[model samples]
Target: MLRSDDLQVFVLTAELGSLSAAARQLELSPAVASAALKRLEAQLGCRLLVRSTRSLRLTGEGELYLPHARSALQSLVEGQQLLAGGKATISGTLQLSAPSDFGRNVLLPWLDEFQLQHPLLSLRLLLADRNADLFRQPVDIALRYGQPEDSSLVAVPVAAANRRVLCASPGYLAANGSPRTLADLVHHNCLRFMLAGRVHERWCFLDDRHRELEQLVSGDRVSDDADVVRRWALAGRGVVYKSWLDIAQDVQSGRLVVLLPELLGEPTPLNLICAHRAHLGERVRLLREHLVERCQRLIQLAPFAH
Candidate 1:
């Protein structure tokens, strides 16, 4: 029979991808963690990992053993929770990552409510526009905009937010005149968010038939920050294509106006992603459900929720 301690260490090592990380998590020395893994492998008569100075890769045997180890650990945790009964409350740290703007305006407020309900749960939230690697980082969950392409992590659709919209200040529109069609945008000063390294300045639009139209919209001013783009539009610099949520307040305040609203497209789905563990704990389930519920409420009241 596989020892439960050995199984726990195996699962930790697999999840963390390093002996030192697993050791830190388990509160064991690296040497002890390595010894435990060696012993576990020796007992099973199979090598588990291909270790290098910079990286660790699971071998065929290691991959096969991973699911079993995770299952054993999850079963143990569930059994403990069952034994604890009503006292089995979630009381651990949950690390989350999200875009800076969404984190500030949307996630933080909902998190405040979630915290009030679950006072025992501690949270570590990181706000960034860049993609976070859950396998490399110590984050438990990440809220990502748009659909995720990574198959390694499990992604759950939490909310749907409107996509990029083309808009400008009323003053700018009065001077440049409003674009009547998609082709008219090319002749106008289009502010674009250049995702740091991309060469092309392409903008996508949806026609009345719902067909996608990709155009090379040009402008002298370009930035990656949505706030900066909004500011530029407010200053009457040029037309900007940005997320509706980022510009909704400005639009409502009349600091900016949606130009060519007929050309805008459908919204993108917001996803909450996490590493694929064998089983999800009650805390994760509860938090995920809460976020989904909150997002639904927001969608109903959202200005662009058409």
Candidate 2:
């Protein structure tokens, strides 16, 4: 029977592409990591990897066994989490990837509160506008907007009623009157944010007759970070199509005003995503529940919900 530590070292080495790098990540000596992998190969009676002075590659046999090894480790993790000796302190690092704006302005506070509750648990957060590669990235969970098209991921809808609210700063609205109609949007300076690599200049909304409308709105500025767009909108730069949860406080505070209530924009799903089905763990489940409850409150803050 191969030790779980050996399996862990093997997986980390494969992912990081270097035994020494994996050792450093695991906080183990390079000699120990190399020895563990050697022990694993010895138990299986085969060389699992080919190593040179400066390179290492998995052998064909190693490739065949990799998936099974990964599956086994995942199962062990799930079992440990689920079968914790009653009331065992849930302590481990939970790494997450999130969108820039929501992560900073929203999730950051929630996570801080959670950490306070679970003083033993460590957290690592990566904030960015781009989607993280769950299979390759060192992330346990991800918070995302919109439904992911990939069938490989498991996504739980945390906030289903999140809609984009058209908004402009009071200063901008006073400087250049608010849009009263969908057609009026063309007359105002629109703000845009980049998604996945393309500029999302085409704003989506519902017409007065409830027909879906897509407008190719142009803007004087565009940024990959949604927070920047929000800032620009607050600074009276231009009109912005943003999630109500994102701009609710600003709108409620009267810093930003909603525009064209008749033109209802589409709702984007807020999801908590994971790469594999490991039942996630007690802490992750509770975290999901906490986020759901919090997100529902934010969703309720929306001035218009359909």
Candidate 2 root-mean-square deviation in Å: 3.4
lDDT of 1 by residue, 211-273 (tens): 998877888887765456667888999987766656656677788887777675456677878
Per-model TM-score, in order, reads 0.68, 0.84
Tell me the alpha-carbon RMSD of every candidate.
4.9, 3.4
User: How many angstroms is residue 306 displaced in model 2 relative to the true structure, after the best TM-score fit?
Assistant: 7.7
lDDT for each candidate structure = 0.74, 0.82
Q: List runs of model 1 lying over 4 Å from the truth.
A: 1-79, 86-89, 169-178, 225-237, 249-256, 277-280, 301-304
- Whole-model lDDT, candidate 1? 0.74
On residues 1-306, what C-alpha lDDT tens digit does candidate 2 reach at each position?
889999999977876789999999999998999899999999999987898879998887877666556657756765676677633355666778988989888888899888887787788899998988776566778889987778888898888888898999989988999776777888889999998789998888887788898888887999999999999999999999998878877888999988877777778788888876663666677788888899898777776654
Candidate 1 RMSD computed on C-alpha atoms after optimal superposition onto the true structure? 4.9
Model 2, residue 302: displacement in angstroms?
0.5
